[model samples]
Target: MIRNPSWVLRSYPSGMPTVGNWMLEDRPIPEATKGELLAKTLWLSVDPYMRGRISQAKNYATGFGVGDLMSGGGVGEVIKSESPDFKPGDIVVSDYFGWQPFTTIPASSAKLVAATDAPVEASLSFLGMPGLTAYFALLKTGDPKEGETVLISAASGGVGQIAGQIARIKGLDPVAVAGTDAKLEWCKQLGYRECVNHRTSADLVADVAAACPNGVDLFIDNTAGPIHDAAMLNLNTFGRVVVVGTVALADRFDQPDIGLRHLRKTLIARARIEGFLLDDHESEFETAKADLLSWFKQGLFETREDVIEGIEAVPYAFVRMMNGENFGKQLVKL
Candidate 1:
């Protein structure tokens, strides 16, 4: 009997998203089926990648059609269950069901968690897709080693924050870049060896060269504008660049600016720049989830979530995320 609002996309957004772009509706939750659980959503995620979901873009995942419920990742507590796997009061994360107070989830799509003081909300952030994305990019693709220098943009965002911290744990010197003072401070707190402000600095190549005197051995990119252009010029020979995301490109529907001078660097330095999606690493997701849970228990990882309360706030949160107003991961509590 939860009476909460649900947000559904009314139309596709071109640049910045707006409330008009989303339609709010009310609906009743149905009974839980066999091998299913009815959970109350405590927190709902709002990410820039979601913008692509609203449009019928040729994306990695199927786009959410107009009039379909606009859902994202979420952390919820099961209140009713018909599955052997899940009982009452189990915290779980879901990808398809969101923007509401309650949803029915299949046991296969939901993983039960025993909640602790760390907040089950982290299961949707650092301990989930974003964290796994960072882990694989740094360790598997980038292959950063001790004494190596690494560069990361959007260092305060969910993926970049964990990527830099993981790089440090692996004995690499991580040079972090962010847009604001508060974010730079967070990057420092995350144990990044060096920090840079992309907004103030004009000479990113010089800044990256100064911060990473040995030349960047790997680049974990979240922004692909000026910062990427600058960092590519300073890559060490045979360096690796892991392109996990482009917040800037994502805003423009992944149509980033034409060409990269970095291509020359890739050819000359024999550096490899590759992109990846967390979905491609499902086999490793469970392993990463367990490892992240351990890290969270030990306080090895932490992130800021700009949570906008109420399901009606979903559209605004999406707008804010694309506008870069929210820090870390943007989400809504239903």
Candidate 2:
């Protein structure tokens, strides 16, 4: 008699979300039907983008309503399969799995986890959405060139860490801007040419400018707000800005995003700014995944995971990540 316990959205948050916004309920485990697979979740991912999903405001994807299951990405082992493409004991990853221990999803919606020397949990971090986001966003959007300075905000984060490493690999100089001294130290080990602790810096713009003596040619913005302002002020002529996450403004999503305008700097620097979403680059996923896997196996990449155990810890884990307490990719092992 297995039970499927899920975290359900109890209410939308007006500011930062609290555990009160969700309710965990126990239900019967669902059976796999035709063309579907029933899987037991092994690892669950908690990311900043999830903040948007729980919001009442409109997003590119559908938002969850009160009483709906809190959905996210998860890697699980197939316990039962009714589809010809999969069999029992196969491991798969899917975005359709909610905050639950077991899920029954259409086989077409999940992808088989490729064999890797790295832990299967890597499928959710550097080798999955975060890595893919960093890959296409930097290479395609930022368009890095040799010797150029690429400034990365949230440089120690899941996506930011990978982005900075990719920049270094491409012969570009990576300048890291993270919140803590410890995080900046980790970025240095990852090959970043320079590091700035935004939380302690008296003048971030000046610090960023000093780090990128030649001016920033590419800015991979993940935290936005002050980091965005700093990068814009130091952008080089013909530079590019790839907007990723806005974790700094997570609490203000429901309110107007009031901030310093960069229009003047944009015009003066002739810089190109573009927002990125991993979902938009589906056609290039396999190619990017192949490259990431190769780079990872060759010892060219490194990442950290802040993991917690049990289904009951999911909500608190997410809150910790949102508060910048998690060192790297935040995960829940069930």
Candidate 3:
């Protein structure tokens, strides 16, 4: 029997979360039944969105039941299986189970490996929900046109990075806004036409106005708050703003107040601000997967995973991500 270590939600978070809200515990694995696979986790995906899951409020899904195995998404190797569809050695990705060393799941929940040395984590990163989120949000909602200026907040992150690339692919001038100089530099290397450090900009309205002489045509908001307020002020007439995340104020289900100033500007400029859900585009996942895979093959994209080595580190990693300590995709390893 394998000992499965998992991080559980002990209490709901208030404002920024701390390690106290979670606790690590150990459990045992059972033998796989027919049509099931006994999988050993190798990597765990820790994302910022998980903060909402632990809270006692409504989000894309119902809030995770208190004390239920804290689950999101994971990639694992099948060590033993009773299903003919899966062999002893196979990798599967799913939102199946939590921070555990082992989990037994039906073969259907498992997605088979189509590529070798697939880094598996990409199933949870670029090839998974985040990638889909970025793909559809840009093409369907943000809709940047050729030669138009695209400004993305949280530009160095998993979703933001992918969105920036998609903007470039669509022939838009993509400018990324990040928290640090290093992240801004990385954005530039990733082909952003312009990059700015959110930490350094004292007057983001003036800075963005200076950077985009013609004004921003599309704004992809991940870090919403002051950046949002400032960006709306600098938006070109008919600018489209896509609200993907509101990480700037943490995971409060109640929407943040943007004040009348920015609200008035949005209306005056004839701007359209829309919210998006990635799962709504799940029907087009295969299409998104094919295009994203093509980009990967062409060496057009790369991802950073802040993967902690063990289940013991899951709490710390999560707290770190909530406080904006991680630079890219934040995940924990089994």
Number of clashing residue pairs, candidate 1:
0
lDDT (10s digit) by residue, model 3, range 1-334? 5567777788787778788888777866757888888888777777767777777666777776668767667788888978778887888887765677787777777787567434678888888888888898888888767899989988878798888887877788999888888888888887898877778998888888887888999999987788887788889999989988888877453455554466778778999999887867778989998898888878878677777787788778877876777888787877
- Local distance difference test, per candidate? 0.79, 0.89, 0.80
lDDT of 1 by residue, 15-126 (tens): 5567788888887775788888888888887765676677666877788778877677888889898988888988888786667788777778887655555677776678
Candidate 3 — which residues are off by over 4 angstroms?
Answer: 30-37, 80-87, 105-108, 116-118, 251-261
TM-score of each: 0.92, 0.97, 0.91
Clashing residue pairs found in predicted model 2: none
TM value for model 1: 0.92
For candidate 3, the clash count comes to 1
lDDT of 2 by residue, 1-334 (tens): 8778999999998788778889999977877899989999999999999999899888877999999988788999999999999998999998877788988877988999978897999989988889899999999888888999999988888898999899988899999999888999999999999999999999999999899999999999898788999899899999999989888887787887777988888898888999999989999899999999889989999998889999999999988888788898899999
Candidate 1: where are CA atoms >4 Å away?
31-35, 254-256, 259-261
- In the order shown, the candidates' Cα RMSDs to the true structure are 2.1, 1.2, 2.3
Q: What lDDT score goes with residue 166 in model 2?
A: 92
Q: Where is model 2 more than 4 Å wrong at Cα?
A: none
